[model samples]
Target: MGNSLAAIGARHQMWESTSDRLSSSSDSCGGPVVSFGQALRSAMETRDDPESLGTSSQDLADVDEQDVADSSRKSSVSAETAEKLCTIPREKGLDAQDFRCAMCRKTIGGSTFSKFETCAIDSKYYCTECMKSGGKVSIPARVVMDWDWRERAVSDRGRAWYEANQEKALINIKTTNSRLYAHAPALEETRKLREKLQLVSMYLFTCRESVSEDFRRRLWPKEYLRSEIDVYSFADLIDVKSGALQRRLNSLLKHSINHVMTCTLCKQKGFCCELCTVNEVIYPFNTESTHRCLVCFSAFHVECWRTSGDCPKCVRRQNFETRRAQVDDPHNTLLVLQP
Candidate 1:
């Protein structure tokens, strides 16, 4: 078990490094590095910075350095708390010195240790006294992973803290807990549908036909699905499990398909199978039935493209170019053939 935890931690570190490089590349390309987590944080009220509390040296002199240090330490501890206990390595026994009520900073051990309850989302311990004063909340992790919205008990401070940040879109299960997708077939299915919806959205927005702004807003807010397809918030996951998001995606896709089939501008954007005599207009979104030519980028029936060894369009273009070169300069020592 220790080995497994170590391996997971190593992989997470590697992924973080890769993400850092990608972020740098995105910045270099002048694209905004607006991730799903960033969007969630932006929606919440800004946090107060301990150092920024004092504007001048006179104000700083009046402040107690010890208080600022304690606040900083507490903030760091809170931030280190994992959303799920499974993500971190843990032991069976609790140490009084190590464990404390996350809310009140009360030491949790001795006779009352067994009676203490844990927060489902943050996995923090709460003393019996704190638990008595707390309320119940639908654990965000349970809602996203299990589609379970049943309320669970937590300390009052925990409840208030959760309410302050519940709307913040922190967990992205696909990247964080990929094993869930394998075990939970429903989640994987929803993910695939969402990806297809992304493709459909691209087609609709890029087409010459003007899609209604209201419909776009209803489908997915610009903040959520801006330019990336994989980024999803807790709200999105919840909606998917509840069938609301899936229904919206289906409606939008149906509209897009109808527009493509009927509108002259949209139809013109489609490609025809050049490899076969059977003529049909195929869109890029139909990945199952059509294959695109590598060189000319024309769509063709899957079987027809596979049977033909090479792209017929490229062959014909090359032959025509060669013939034209001979006709233009028959006696030329060197003939330049266009590729």
Candidate 2:
């Protein structure tokens, strides 16, 4: 295993345990969660500084000196406590933490479109911030296996190309087969082309060598069909595994006999009120909100207007407009009117 896998070596085990806690059904985030370093950092951000807590500048200076003196690392925090900070519902508003980033702990309810990102390997929530800055993405066994098969296929193609061109190569024509005489310019062209192909072939082979076999089959099922591409593509619609009550409502209650599903957002299967939602996944026609976003054109529940922030798509548009105004400042280059 590489250093990146060693980093999550501990937490990945806890994430797998979510299956045991799946049926908790407590009207909140249901299941185990990830590391809580982000949540702890958020708590510290909200705390008042010592200056506002009735402490003098001189006294604060003394306390700060003391804290610096005792800066040695304490005993390691319990792994159990660290994991607990990742899951929540202790308070009413905390249900939002279900969609919190596994790394930064940024919660989702801040906007209509959830900022929470899903891990392709374990199906856990990782925010976009963590993915970009944090480092190499770690995959569980299942996904790594998929990559392995692809690598093999690429290698086979490269080998076949070499076999077809080996006899026609300029070197072979010059020494072995004197009948096929080529002038200097033509030989140069053929040599350059072969070198380029060889470089590309070696580059792909190196990539396969760097990856380990440990991450083969993680979250995806054992029996999924591997298509010409991943037989399972991004646009492919999957049928939901229906529950008894949902079936009853469809048949006996004369409702639109359909399905209720749990989408694997960021890989983990849960409700995060983002691109994948109860209404968006299970019932497309019965939208939660009637008002469609001006940017994405997706409907958001009317209650979005009352929230502290706007929809994610609209927020993106506003940010773009603001940036344009700043960058195109009229005074930056004086435009004298050509009267």
Candidate 3:
């Protein structure tokens, strides 16, 4: 009996030590903790009456159900509060909600709740602890919109997500937020010039001119070439805002245009404005003077296209089709000579 009692005491001491550790961990995580005494009392009550086990189980079920309901209610309320906070005007500031770390959802900012750092992306507040714990990151939104390369404080998880997706062509300023154009009109012009450069690069790609090498190197990176004009990575956007990208595009465009106009091999790819009698070579990149036919893809002078309202190549193709059809018919005995 003494040995059995000693064993029970040892087990009780071990359980107490484990419970103390558990209590400390739970407190750190802001989770509920049931003390060793309460747990022991509950177990004793259930053991005292064999019939009371079912009642105790039912009570636990009730408590679990109540906890679930409360958790759901809190989640819904948090979602609604976040939505309202997003709707609030930025100029007015978010003084309504108590300052808390956006990353850990921890209560921070001391007594006044005014000491905090803002995330560069959404301007959300974060605590110094969160910032020290891997919160510094470059926001992709600011990189794409403003070409900001400076890192700012964010949640650790948020920083991880951004670093993982930094290379992706995810942000499309044209489709997502076009108001940036209204704010910075020069940016719109830059995009337009880039589009034109994209077209010009097509002509330069097949040409044997020495400038083609320069064009390939300077006419945007290969990854960026796959994306539309509005889509860009942080590195490319930074280069653009720094004026290096624009300078390269201008130099390449000028050289490639000169090569296309002068080189015989390059001119073979050019189109003559058939809509008019002008013998000058025309290309699609010459947007000011040339108009490309939508149906036949033939180039023509913009003024000639405006007057005729038809493509000369398209008209010739239609006439040839008509003659071929007539010749194919047995009813028409005339032999049509193909041009």
Off by over 4 Å in 1: 1-99, 112-114, 132-154, 157-174, 208-215, 220-226, 291-298, 303-339
Compute each candidate's TM-score over C-alphas.
Answer: 0.55, 0.17, 0.52
By lDDT, highest first, what's the ranking? 3, 1, 2
lDDT of all predictions: 0.55, 0.31, 0.56
**What's the lDDT for candidate 2?**
0.31
| Pairs with backbone N, CA or C atoms under 3 Å apart (clashes), candidate 3 | none
Residue-level lDDT of model 2, residues 289-337, one tens digit each, is: 4333333333344554345235554454455555445435756333333
Which of the two, 2 or 3, has more TM-score?
Answer: 3
Q: Give the least accurate 10-residue stretch of model 1, judged by summed lDDT.
A: 22-31
Q: What is the Cα-based TM-score of model 1?
A: 0.55
Q: TM-score winner among the candidates? A: 1
* Order of models, best TM-score first: 1, 3, 2
> How high a TM-score does candidate 2 get?
0.17
Count clashes in each candidate, considering only residues at least 3 apart in sequence or on different chains. Answer: 1, 15, 0
After the best TM-score superposition of candidate 1, give how far the Cα of residue 329 lies from its true spot, in angstroms: 19
